[model samples]
Target: MKGTMVALGGGGFSMSEDGASALDDYILAMTKRPRPRICFIPTASGDADTYSERFEAAFRDRADTSVLSLFCHEPWGYSDPAMLLEQDVIYVGGGSTANLLAIWRLHGLPEMLEKALDSGTVLAGISAGMNCWFESSSTDSYGPLAPLDDGLGLIPGSACPHYLSEPRRRESYQHWVATGALADGFAVDDYAAVVWRDGAFVEAVAEQRDRPVFWVERTADGVVEREIPVRLLGQ
Candidate 1:
């Protein structure tokens, strides 16, 4: 069976002031189980305590939540990589994409995550979390926006998050694709997310109606960006 993934451009619990969002609720609802086992992987943020704490607080009443911290190895964190397989949803946090990839590779998390996905664990994340699954992505991990081709490749092509909220993201990504620096890919504005099942895009969703998602591709003339219709959540 194919796995399910929710890749958010932004606007999840982390970005929300109250640590709640329609996007997050949508993710939880995907599990189709009361009190789904949810694990927060904060490797991207260096396993920051606040991030985990916020995650726990956000999902506390809705799901069985635990955090997997790679830096401090807290008692509540998932130490055994195999434990990830038991989660109903593995939610990754946003941070330095490059560093997240490095640490995850060192800990053999890539393999473990694949296993978790195969076991029907819903994979979800924002920003770097969203970028990791694609073959390439536009990221600020290197201090400046650049193309990162070394991604998990769970999804084909490339991706760019914070497309609308971040300055120059759209232009830079379009230039990269047009110049053959990055593969044809999707770009999502903050407050928007794309859903995939069996590695194929199922739909685009958003917490805000104004935010949008785009499919960017290199054409003979130049780069073309087609806006993907978004389903506004909580409607």
Candidate 2:
């Protein structure tokens, strides 16, 4: 089955007291399944219990929620990694993109997640989670903001999250792409997400007010950018 993947620039049900339900709701709708099984993969934050708890509390009523804690070595009742296939959606939490990829490799989760996605699981995440699906991304994982061109390659090109919220993120991503250090690709501000359905670009959606989703590329003149109009949920 052709699967869907939604990469969030930032903001999610797990991140705020007011709770951004738009993105979370859109993610659930993408499952196209009644009472979808949603699993939270919090490896980025080193599988922090607080992050997992936030996910559970936020999604408890929306879907059958569970946490996959790789650091704790707890399987969350499933004996094998293959059980990931049973999930309808896997939501990755934000943190260090480099570290998250390392741990996932160590646990052999990359292959498993690939399989899950191929079998129709909607793979989605925020920040680092957003950055991991592409060929590369701009990240703060290694102290100073830098380019991480070694991603899972599930999607072509690069990605940048918190594009507007963080002052350095915009310039760093643009500069990296301009210098050929990072591939030209998409970048979304916090609370915005770019959605893909059946491997095709769908639309940019936002939980808060409409924010621009940028397509950045190098040109003969210089680095160029075009804003992709966003559709705010509930508008």
Candidate 3:
């Protein structure tokens, strides 16, 4: 079965405060299941309680929400990675991309996520969550924006989230792609998400108007970039 993944640059149920719930609403609709089982993975922030609590509050009444914490200490080797594969949707939160990758690798979550995807789970996330899906991405893991070459590679190219929020993000991603430091990839503005189905680009979605996703690649002449139109949701 073909599965879907929505990689959000920023702005979602947990981040937006202007009564803007469009992106999260879209995620819910994507599940195509009543009371869909949605799991939140917050390992990026060291499985911090506050982040998980924010997630729970945002999704509490919207779906059947649960959190899978990988770093809990209290005989808390309690979570089964297998549970991740059972959900209808998996949402990852933003944080240190490098640390997240390292921890996920330690727990074999990358493999489990792939299995979950194959089972038609709708995977989604913002920032670090978005970066994890690509072959590589521009990240702030090293204190300044830099290219991260190893990713889950579920998507075939690189990606940059928070393209608009972070001033250096666009330039860094473009330079990396142009210098052969990173493969050709996509980038998205805040509040925007690039959607993929069966690992193919479908379209971009945004909670706000005019937020676009870009395709960037190295060209003989220089780096080439173009905006991919985004469909505004929750209008």
User: Which candidate leads in lDDT?
Assistant: 1
Please give the lDDT score for candidate 3.
0.87
Sort all candidates by TM-score, best to worst.
1, 3, 2
Identify the runs in model 1 with alpha carbons over 4 angstroms from their true place: 73-78
Per-model tally of clashing residue pairs: 0, 0, 0
Q: Model 2, residue 172: what's the lDDT?
A: 88
Q: Which residue runs of candidate 3 sit more than 4 Å off their true CA positions?
A: 18-20, 73-77
Give a tens-digit lDDT track for model 3, residues 1-235.
Answer: 2579999999897676633478988888887877889998888888877777777778777688888888873323449889998899999999999999999999899999999999989999999999999889899988999999889989988999998788888888888999999999888999899999986889898988878889997999979999888888854
lDDT of 1: 0.92
Where does candidate 2 stray beyond 4 Å? 73-79
| Steric clash pairs (candidate 3) | none
Q: State each model's CA lDDT, in order.
A: 0.92, 0.87, 0.87
Q: Candidate 2 residues 69-122, lDDT tens each?
A: 777644453235676889999999999999999988988898998899988899
TM-score of 1: 0.97
A best-first ranking of the candidates according to their lDDT comes to: 1, 3, 2
Residue 154 alpha-carbon offset, candidate 3, angstroms: 0.4
